[model samples]
Target: MATDGQILRLAQWLSPAYPVGAFAYSHGLESAVATGAVADGAALTDWLADILRFGAGRSDTIFLRAAYEAPPEDLPRIDALACAFQPSAERRTETTAQGAAFARVTAAVWPDDLPDFTYPVALGRAARLHDLPLGLTARLNLQAFLSNLVSAGIRLIPIGQTEGQRVLTALQPLCEEVAGLALTETLDDLAGTSFLADIASMTHETQYSRLFRT
Candidate 1:
């Protein structure tokens, strides 16, 4: 059985019904597939694996954990950190829009006192308010990210439904590792190393025909 708080948090973040618009962004997966960078199941698996292991998984997790534990006064500093971390213009826009969306939805429902919590910070605070364990919160957030990416990949690569599920299954181990790593990470550890992804996101902005916002 689940606790009331845990259930509520999961309902808010993990539900496809949430209005965060998370389902709309691929985090650059659409651009990569359009460019023939990720064509099939194996390639999709590899790309998503790298992201979970090295990109958002590591960096966003650190931010989320720190935001979860930071003093309330430090929220603005954390938002600035989030802004600094995103190097690409499109990616930056994506995070900012999503963060804003999350803040709006949360504010409408819970009405927190802070001016605006960045996406990761708002999520951390929401998790705490909903009584979610840190690990569960991180895991679910990462899962949503991967799921959205794959959903975008399915459209861009024009793959069948089965292939998408296979890709998702193949990346499960990597996602688990990422979540475990995030649980013990510190704020100073917030970083990512995927120049290709950054470049792809930047290029995506100028792409004449884009299926995704980022």
Candidate 2:
């Protein structure tokens, strides 16, 4: 469980209004929709569930846990590993941009820990500082990803607001499952199996008129 203050801080970082430019990127859902791969709310939900099971959810949650438990001296190595794991140029750029921006904003408010804070690191430290449990922190991190993905899906598929909410509601169990799994994962266990999502993200670079950044 998270202390109220910890929840508040996590909310600030995870909120869509945080100015991380999270709204501007769809994580390839836009491309997937444009190409007719994701045609409806059910399809969108399925795609997102796959991502939660095997893509960003798995990899990022592992990194978040590692950063949370790691000695402060090992942050640089973790950052390097994170940078290297991103295979797509767009994905790498997006993560770097968001992580750097997250570090900047958190630094302005809490300077002492900023130097070693990658995005996940900052989040974990904030959670720990405020006495939030690891499970809650991990769930919030995964929720942020799901929220961003659905936001992208809404735009790309042009789905109704109600429909988007439906998709999110449908994935709650899976989100909990992923969060639980994340708690026990090592960095070596981090892996992504969503090749279609990766390829779509890579293809977005050459897309003539893209609505989302990646």
lDDT (Cα atoms) of all candidates against the true structure: 0.78, 0.81
Tens digits of lDDT, candidate 2, 1-214: 5578877877888899887778877888878887899999999999999988988877888888887787777777887788788858888877778877777776777654655344666666556555667888899878888988898888888888899999999998899999898889888887879999998888888888888889
lDDT comparing candidate 1 with the true structure: 0.78
How many Å off is the CA of 118 in candidate 2?
Answer: 4.7
What's the lDDT for residue 128 in model 2? 58
Candidate 2 global TM-score: 0.94
Question: Model 2, residue 177: what's the lDDT?
Answer: 98
* TM per candidate: 0.93, 0.94
Model 2, global lDDT: 0.81
Per-residue C-alpha lDDT of model 1 across residues 1-214, encoded as one tens digit per residue? 4577686777676666888777777788777887889898888888888887778767887888887777777878887888788868877777778778787777787775534555677788667665578887887788777887888888888788888888888877778788888879887777788766777887888889876888
Predicted structure with the largest lDDT when compared to the true one:
2
